[model samples]
Target: MAKTIHIALVGNPNSGKSSLFNVLTGLNQKVGNFPGVTVDKKVGSCQLADGLNATIIDLPGTYSLYPRREDEWVAYRVLMQQDKEVVEPEMVVLIADASNLKRNLLFASQIIDLKIPVVVGLTMMDIARHKGIQIDVAELERELGVPVIPINPRKNKGIQPLKKAIEQTALELYKAPVRDFINNEALAPAAIGSVKELFPELSDYKAIHYLINHESFALHGHLQEKIESIEQVNNFNHTKTQAEEILQRYQRIGSILKQSVSEPSPLKKTLFTEKLDNIFLHRRWGYIILLAVLFLLFQSVFWLAEYPMNIIDWGFGEISSWLGNVLPSGWFADLLINGIWAGLGGILVFIPQIMILFGLVTILEDTGYMARISFLTDKLMRKVGLNGKSVMPMISGFACAVPAIMSARNIENKKERLLTILVTPLMSCSARLPVYTILIGLVIPKTMFAGFLGLQGLVMMGLYLLGPIMSMFVSYIARFFINIKEKSFFILELPVYRAPRWKNVLITMVNKAKIFVFDAGKVIMVISLILWALSTYGPKEKMRSVAARYEQQIKQHPEQEAELNRLKNTELLQNSYAGLLGRSIEPVIQPLGYDWKIGIALITSFAAREVFVGTMATLYSVEGGDDADENTLMEKMNAAVRPDGTKVYSLATGISLMIFYAFAMQCMSTLAIVKRETRTWKWALIQLVYMTGLAYIMSLIAYQLLK
Candidate 1:
C-alpha cells in the first residue's frame, strides 16, 4: 500500500510558496476554508516516490509564528498542532528567498527551534546573484541543521531533488535539534518551565511561545489562569522579551552568515527594482502610466474578444435552430430551446471577455506592477481614511467582492479593514461585465479617436474606475462615525519586475472560464428554467382567454398567419405569470426607464448580478418568433419596444441601468461574505441599504436628466 504522509509549505509573503505549490501539485489541488475560519486552505496530493504519497498543505504566508491577523493565527494553530481539524505536517518545507536570507532566516531559525523536520527550499538565487550576493548552500544547511535545497520552482529547477528530500525526511523519524537556534531557555527561563509543566511534550521554543501567546491559544479557562499567574509571578514584559529574543536571533544569524554567505556593501550598488521605480513609481508619470495600462486592459477586453464572442453566439443560435427543427413541436421542445438553451447561451457568450480580463490582471500581478499600483495610490488612499494595503482588496474587487472582502484580513487596522470590506462591492466585479458590455454596446458608439483610442473601451474603463472613486468618498465619510481609534501604517514590499509566466496566465484564464461556465452556469440554468415556466404559463383563466382571443384573430386573418402568430406569442407572454410579477414592480422602476420585463430581471438578478443577462434571454426567447431569423439577446434588446412604441433600451435607459448596476449591492453572496468577515449583520445591513439607496438615487438622476 502507498501510505500518505503530510507535508506543509510555509514562507513569508511573496516568498514563492504558492508558486512552488502550483509546480508540485499541478492540477491535483483543491481550495477551501479552514475549520471555523474563512482563511483559505489549499491542499493537494503529490506522488513523492513509489509507495510514498504526500499530501501537501500550503499554509498562509507570515513573517513569523507570532500571531496578529486571522490568517497568521491559522498558520500558527496548524504549526503548533493545536487545531483539532488540521493535522500537523510530518515535514515542513521552509521556502526562503536567497536574495534576503537574513530576514528569511529569522523565521527559519524559529521553526528549527520547534524541533520539527525542516527543509529549506532556497528561491530567487538568480536574483540574489544579480544583486552581487552569494550563498554556499551546504554551509547554510549545516549551520541551520536541515537539508537546504537550492531550487527555483518557477523555472522547474531542482524540484525533483526537493521532492526526494521531502520523501526521505518524512520516512525517517524526526530528530530534535541538538542545540537551540538561539538561547531560548535563557530568554525567559521561569515562564518556559511553568508552561512546560502544563504541556510536558513541548520543546523549549514552543514553551516560550505558549507563555507569550497563551491568550490566543485554544486553552481551558483554568489553564489560561495558570499561564497568567506564571506571567504575573515572573514579572514578564511581553514587548521587552520579544525584542530581546529577536535581537539575540539576529546576532547568531549574523555570525552564521559570515561563514556561509557574502554580499556587496549596501552603499556601493543600487538594485534593479530601485532603478525601475524611477519611472513606474514617479509621482506624476506613475499615474499616467497607470491610466494607460488600465485603458489598454479594458480595450483589449473588447478588441481581442469580439471574434470569439460572435462565434459563440452564432454557434448557439445554429444549435437551437437545429434542435427546434429536429424535435417535435411540443412543451418539452419549447422548454429545452427557449428556457434552458437560451439562458445558457446568454451567459456563455461572455466567456471570452472574462478570460481576457483575468489574463491581463494576472500579468500585472506576475510582473509586480500591481504592488506599485498600491504604492502610487497610497497617498490618495490615506486621504480617504485608508492606506496602501486597502488598494489591493479594492482592486481585487474587480474579480469578485466575496474574495476581495476576505482578503481584507491582511489589513492590520480593524477600522480600515472594515471600511474596505464595506465598500469593496461598489467596485465592478466580473459579474457586472456582461451587463456593462451589453448596455454599453447599446448606448456608446464604437468610434475610434486618433485612429487608436476606442470610445466604447474608454467608457468601460470609466465604469471600473467609478467604484474606487466612490469607495474613497464613502470611506472618508464613514470613518468619522465608526469610533475605532488606532494608529494605522502602510508598509509594503515591492517585488522586482519579471516577465509573466505564460503557462500560469493560460491556466488562470482557463480556470476563470470554467468557474463562469460551471458555477455561474448552474445559477443561470435554474433561473432560466423557472423563468421559462413563468413566461410560458399564466393563471388558468387568463391563459385560456389569451389562447381563445389569439385563435379568433388567426381565424379572422388567415391570410396574415405569420404576423398574427408573432402577435399572439407576444400577447401570451405579456399576460403570463412572469409578466404579472414584473408588472407589480413596474411602478417603482418605471422612472428609471425600465418596463415590467426588465423589472422581473432586476428582482431575480438579486441572487447574482450576471443572472440579469440570463433572465433577459429567457423573457425575449419566449416572446421571439420561431422563424430561423431570430437575433441574439443584444439585437433583441435593441429592437424591443415599450407599450408607447418607443425603444425599450434607449440611450437614457441603457446608461441609467449601467449606472444602477455600478452602485447596487445586488449580490447576496457578497452580503453574506461581508457579514461573515465583519462578524456583524449591522455593518452588512448598512452596506446593503446605503449601496442600494445610492444606486437608486444616482440612476434616477441620470435617467431624468437624459429623458
Candidate 2:
C-alpha cells in the first residue's frame, strides 16, 4: 500500500496561491465549510506516480503567522494543529510572486520555522523575465534548504515538478537539513539571543512567539516544550521582550535577502504595470470609465436577455396551455397548469438577467480590474465611513446580496464589515430587475430622450443608481453610532492583468445560476402553490350563495348573461380565502393605492421578489374565463379599478411599488447570508426592520406625493 501525502499550500494574498490550487486540482476540488465555522475549506486530490495520491488543502491567504481577521485565524489554527485529523501537513508548498519576492518572503520565513518539509513555488517567472528580473533558482533553493520551482500556474507550467517534489518528501526519499543551510549564522544567533534576554522566564518558542508578536503561538504545546529548552540555556536573562525578538528576526531576514539577491539596476522600469494603472486608477477618468462599464452591464442585462427570456416565457406558457387542453378537467390538471407551471415560469424568466450579471462580475474579477476599482474608490469610500475594501461587496450586491455579504468576510474591521453587509441588500439585486422592468414598462412613456436616453432607459438607470446613493447615506448614519478604534487601511496588490479565463468564468456563471434557480426557486414554487390553492378554493357555502344570486340576475336580464357571469367570477374571487387574506391586509396598504389582489401579491412576494408575477398569474387564472389569453395578464392588471372607480395600478402605485422593491429585504437567501456573515442575529434583524420601514415610508410618500 502506498502512503497518502497531505500537502498544504500557503502564500500571501495575490501570490497565485488560489490560481495554483485551481491548476493542480482542476475539477477535483471540493468546497465546504470548515468543521465548526462558516469559513471555506477547499481540498482536492491529485494522483501521483506509482499509485500514490496526495491530498492538497489550500489554506486561506495570510500575511504572517500573526492573524487579525477571521479567515486568517482559521489559517493559523489549521497550521498550528498537530493532530493527524487536524493540522498535520507532510509538506508545505509556499507560493511566492517572482515579481515581488521581498514582500512574499515574510510569510515564507515563518513557515520555514515550523520544521515541516517546505518547497517554494515561485510564480510569475515569465512576467519577471519580461520585466528584466533574473533569479538564480538553484542558489535560492540551496540557500533556503528547500526546492524552488519557477512556474506560472496560469500557464500550466511546472506543476508536474511541484507534484514530484511533494511525492519525494511524502515518501521520505528527500531529507534536507533544516538550519544548517543558513549562511548568516551571526544574525540568527544574535536574534535568538535577543529573544532569550527579553523574556528569560518564557520558553524559547514563547520568546520566538513574543518576537513575532504571534500571541496565538503560545497555544501550541510542542512550541511550549521547545521554548522551555531554550529558557534553560545558561546566562539567559528576562530583559528583552518577545516583540523586540521578533523585530530582530525580520531584521535578519532583510539582511539575508540583501546578501543573496542582487539587482542589475536598483530601479528598473515597470512600464507595463504602471502604464495600465495610470489610466485605470485616474481620479476623474476612472470613475467615468467605471460608470460606462456599469451602464454597459445594465444594458446587456436588458437588451441581450430579451430573446432568451421570451423563449422561456413562450415555452412555459405553451406547455401550460397544451397541458390544460390535453388533460382532463380535474384537481390534478388545475394543480399542474395553474400552480406548478406558473411557479416554474416565474423562475425561468429571471435566468437571463442572472447569467448576464454573473458573467460580467466574473470577467471583472478575473481580469483584476475589480481590485483597481476598489483602489480608485477607496478615498471616497472612507469619506463616507466605509473602507475601500467594502466596494467589492457593494458592487456584488447588484448581482445578488447573499454572496455579496459572504464576500465581506475578507474585510477585517468589524464595524465597517457589518455596515457594508447591512447596506448591501439595499443595492437592488438582480432579482429586483424583473419587477422594475415590468412596472416601468407598464407606467413609463415610450418616448426616447434625445434618441439615446429613452424614458424606460432613464428610469432603469435611476432605479439602479438609487440603491448606492441610499446605501451611502445609510452607512454614514450608521457610522455615527458605531465606534471604531482600529486602524483601517486599504492596501491591495494589483495583480498583473491577464486575459479573462473563459472556462473559469463560465463554470462560475453556471454554478451561480443553478444555485439561484434551485435554492430560491424551491421556496418560490412552494409559496406559489399554496397561494394558488388559497385563491382557487373559497368558502363553499359563500361561493354557492354568490353564484346563485348571479344566476338569478342572469335570468332577470337574459341578454346580459355573459357579463353577469364575469361579475360572478370576480365576486367569488373577492370572497375566496386568498381574497379574504388580502382584504384583511388592505387597510395597511390602501394608502399606497393597492387593491386586495395586489395586496396578496405584495404579501407573497416578501418570500422573493420574483414570486410577485407568478402570484399574480395564479390569482388571475382562478378568476378568468376558459378563453383567457396569457398576454392579457398585463392588460387585466392595467384595467383593474377600485370600488370607487379609480385605477388601482395608477402611475403613483407603479412608482411606489418600484421604490418599495428598490430598498426592501425581499430575499430570504440574503437574510440567511447576513446571519452567516455577521455571526449574530442582531445585525440581520436590524437590517430587516430598518430596510422594511424605510421602504414602507418612502413608498407611502412617493404614492401620496404623486397622487
Which one wins on lDDT? 1
lDDT of 2 by residue, 1-707 (tens): 86668888899987888888877777677665565454667888778778788789988888877777666777776666522345477788899988777777767766766556788899978777777767878877776777788878777889899888877777776654446322322333555665566446443343444444433443466555544555555333334443454565667666766665555585777657678888878878888998787667656756777788779978997888899899998879989887898877866676776676677767887788878877777788887789878887787677667656766766776778878988999888767877887688678889977778798888898998999999999999998887766667676778878777776676556655665576557766776688678877889999889989999999899998766776776677778887788889889888877777878777667656876775665555433223344346667777778788988778999999999889888766676557655556687789999998988899999999998
Error of 2 at 320 (Å): 5.5
Error of 2 at 701 (Å): 1.7
TM-score of 2: 0.82
Give the Cα error of residue 154 in candidate 1, in Å.
2.0
The alpha-carbon RMSD values of the candidates against the true structure, listed in the order shown, are 4.6, 5.6
Give lDDT: candidate 2, residue 471.
Answer: 96
Candidate 2 — which pairs collide?
A: 197-240, 198-240, 200-238, 203-227, 204-227, 205-227, 210-242, 211-242, 211-246
Q: How do the residues 533-615 of candidate 1 rate in per-residue lDDT, one tens digit apiece?
A: 88788898987898898789889989987667766676676778877878987998999999888887776677678778767
Candidate 2 segments whose C-alpha is farther than 4 A from its true place: 35-38, 82-87, 180-207, 210-246, 258-260, 301-356, 406-410, 437-457, 480-487, 510-578, 614-635, 675-682
Q: Could you tell me how far off, in angstroms, the CA of residue 146 lies in candidate 1 after the best superposition? A: 1.2
TM-scores of all candidate predictions against the true structure: 0.84, 0.82
Output the lDDT of residue 14, model 2: 77
What is residue 400's positional error in candidate 2, in angstroms?
A: 3.9
